[model samples]
Target: MKRILLLCALVPFTFMTSAQNSRPNIIYILADDLGYGDVSALNKNSQIPTLHMDQLAREGMVFTDAHSSSAVCSPTRYGILTGRYNWRTRLQSGVLWSYDPPLIPESRTTVASLLKQSGYHTACIGKWHLGLGWQQGENGKVDFNKPILGGPTAIGFDYFYGITASLDIPPYFYIKNDRITATVIDSIKGATGKGFWRAGPIGNDFKHEEVLPQLTQKATDYIKEQAAGKQPFFLYYALPSPHTPILPAKEYSGRTHTNAYGDFVLMTDDMVGKVLQAVKEAGIENNTIIIFTSDNGCSPSADFKELKAAGHYPSYIFRGEKADIYEGGHHIPFIVKWPGKVKAGTTTATTICLTDFMATAAALTHRALKDNEGEDSYDLLPLLLQKGVYQRTYTIHHSIDGNFSIRNKNWKLEFAYGSGGWSAPREKAARTQQLPPVQLFDLAKDIAEKNNIAGKNQEIVKQLTHQMEIIINDGRSTPGAKQSNDVPVNYLKYR
Candidate 1:
């Protein structure tokens, strides 16, 4: 009621009130493998500094208990764009590779496509690990000569620029539309060594060292191009930063407690600054919904050993880091700056997931969402706008191995016996300390998830289990009365 009343009061006072369909420009800035501790605004224990990102949080709203859809990359990206859980897809386990099939099916409605249908220009300008099927060559290599198939363009972005997968993956060339920004002339080893990336396909101008600069330039250029047009644009600015092989610009190297990882994160902050500047320079800062977040928690390999040796909690108070089913793997920093709409210097404890983006976009644009559209995504505009405590009802967590952990009304249940993805690779026997086959934590009481309370509360456990079953079987969570929007899409239909 408070939120609704607040919106009612705010709507007339602010120019941001929706017209029949005067949609706002949207910019989603995603950080690769960043943790809750990566940003100073979220964690003050002291690591790398993020000026631009911190500013973003200050100007908008910072969701302290925010989470990524999954603990790893490909799956989380699947959930982010589709607003549905990735596990629902055939990718029941691991992530996608550089040359894999499209993560999103043709029928599924992505934020880009949904907004595009509403007359908003959309573009994805960063890492696209969701996979773009590549054509093979005459000599039996990835025929870099072939146009990338089933990519962002096919997914609804009027303009697309990004990598088919992770930067560490071979065939490290950038893609503009369906063609490689750098052509393949030499054979480069694939990420897992399965395929050789035909190099030289990229221009002599392209180099791994120039990736951040390259993507930044392209994004700024795209913004500039969009500025001239009157179209309300949505830019999915997923940055390729703070991820492995930590390569920061020459000036950003050697600037943090951890190592190259922190350095690269700092560089990513500068990239955010550039984007924010573009929004301001375009004079659309207030109307643009600029959100900064991470795909998932920081990777354990990202200087974790060094940080542990130094007694620094990279994942902060969270038990596991990255791939673990623990909070650290999925808990991430989320900041939204909607100028006139969202309140400044405010924070929310709402347990929201990245999957809610689809619904949020649809709601703000006055479009409806079918129950199956992004079944997992509940509209969070109310929360972001600081209208009131619009509870998420529940948020589900998926581990790298398909293990599931669910959080609803403060009680979280993990279906796995132990730390699902954080196995101590070196010590097989040392893994016994993990939770039993099923562990439960009252996050409202034990935010650290240090104790398992499943045995203590049988009724609660059964109820949550029943709820989880319903969510899985029905293909949508049973919580709030779902709002009618775009017709639901069965992702499995075209798969």
Candidate 2:
């Protein structure tokens, strides 16, 4: 009887261990403001060398039609973690700035929280631009002495280390698990030109040039520590590089010879290599799923003229740069590596959004999400495994200025008269010039989005417009029970 009881206990323990071991470690590397053509593997004519990212592309699947949910960082990040559109929240346009209240509600489920419930340890390192519950003093300044609230830790991450917002944003400091690493007793002057930063409060140790290297070291340390344990971990390494303050390390500066931005990109890729090395050294390479992507397309801060002069187009053949309603703004490079699961060197043209991460994780863990969770996320597992197809037919796109666009395969309909963002013939100018109220493009024939065919294809435009309204009114792009947006979304405001 004693032997039988011991065997039964051992059986359950063994089964549990087996289940845990079966789950793969997930590492999502989100590069800020990286463009499709930045990676040489994705863009053959690129002048910058992204060897590490290229290696990932060679060993895994590359998503050619992948896009951020929005043309900017904050919104895309919100969609990425929540699996819901960012516009559903009150932030209809632009990104969250420093000291902004946490965009995610305390009750909401995030990708990190969802995986944490599924027995995975989660950590978010790098930029937390989604927002934070910053306490303010009577003087209306942020209280640096108190612990922060409603941040990565509050949502789902077991551990969190990053900045309040972008590197260029003020109150420059490091945050570890809801606490500021250093007190902000000093200030720094803002700079312009190549490496620009806003004037604001800065911590003693928060040097903009050293931030990337510090983040990389922290990520590698976390990977090493997690690899020693049995529980699988998910690391969201949000890199703040090649964005602004294009301060490539001394060793990396001038290495690209193309420009400061190009040199910074090379540094970013090298940091990725270091992270990959950490995984390999930890012996978790085979059982780890590494996803490399960008929050959005390249920014104009990269100096498009300089890149073009060097015979490199950051957006490749896409029309506009970041923040535009065109393909160049949101379309990004997405590379996934899962040994033995995803075929090596494979490419998929299936359209997918960053929000899909939530559902994909659910599918990987064989868990069904509630209707209220992951409302806009569609499963990319089928596409990843190359055995099935994506259920998403039409994906909605958002511009920095809150303009809405809908893509149905090769056809795209933009509810904007002009670039909708920081491109030429801005909304005001276009309206003043009496431009059309809407723009449409057949991507198959005009991948650059140079021509507007809205009047020529009224039926297709009508169909897409109706679909966009339904997606917004239904509160989700994916099929589920009718959900509710955190706020009212009016896509017709620009129209």
Once model 1 is optimally superposed onto the true structure by TM-score, how far is the C-alpha of residue 11 displaced, in angstroms?
21
lDDT by residue (tens digit), candidate 1, 344-427: 989988788999898899988889887557778888977877565564687788877667878887888887766667644211
* Cα-lDDT of candidate 2: 0.92
List the global CA lDDT of all models: 0.77, 0.92
Residue pairs whose backbone atoms clash in candidate 2: none
Candidate 1 Cα outliers beyond 4 Å, as residue runs: 1-21, 137-141, 189-205, 308-312, 388-391, 423-435, 478-495
Could you tell me which 10 consecutive residues in candidate 2 have the lowest summed lDDT? 178-187
lDDT measured at residue 275 in model 1 versus the true structure, 0 to 100:
90
Total clashes for model 2:
0
